[model samples]
Target: MSQSNQQRIWQVVSQIPKGKIASYGQVAAQAGIPQAARLVGNVLRKLPEGSKLPWHRVVNSQRKISFPIGSPAYQEQRQRLLAEGVVFNKETIAINHLAWSS
Candidate 1:
């Protein structure tokens, strides 16, 4: 993807408020690159270590963390969301209540 598109993805992710979540598709759409959901995930995955862009606030369209279930990455994402007051029903977040609208 283009650097500008990547930056746009990051900017949208940065705006996801604490206790709120956004799907990859939502981020891509908000970044002005509709239908680029996978690109959004790729941008987030390659975020530099120690970057503070709130990457964990982005999840899959299913309202689930993209990381493998029970894995360390999954656990970390879950913990971060929990710490931010996101309520999960089983493995899925309560998306209707917590999804970020921007």
Candidate 2:
């Protein structure tokens, strides 16, 4: 993706509240580029360490963390969400109950 598009993705991500989670597709749509969910993931993956953006506040459309199980990324994501009081049902979250209302 272009730098502008990536910036737009980051901008949308930054708006996600601390206790809320947004799907990749929802972030893409909010950034005005529908169907760019994978692109959003890519941009998020490339974010520099120590970046202030709330990258952890994103998940897949299934309300599941995108990182592989047992991976450090997966653990970190789950830990962060848990710290924010987000409840999970196995690998998936309750999307209807916790999805952010823009």
TM per prediction: 0.88, 0.88
Lowest-sum lDDT 10-residue window in model 1? 93-102
Task: Report clash pairs, candidate 2.
Answer: none
Residue pairs in candidate 1 whose N, alpha carbon or C atoms collide under 3 angstroms: none
Candidate 2 lDDT for residue 25 = 98
| Total clashing pairs for each candidate | 0, 0
Across 1-102, the per-residue lDDT of candidate 1 in tens digits comes to: 556998899889999998889999999999999999999989988989899999989999998999989999899999999989888877877644645534
10 residues in a row with least lDDT, candidate 2: 93-102
Residue-level error in angstroms, candidate 2, position 25:
0.3
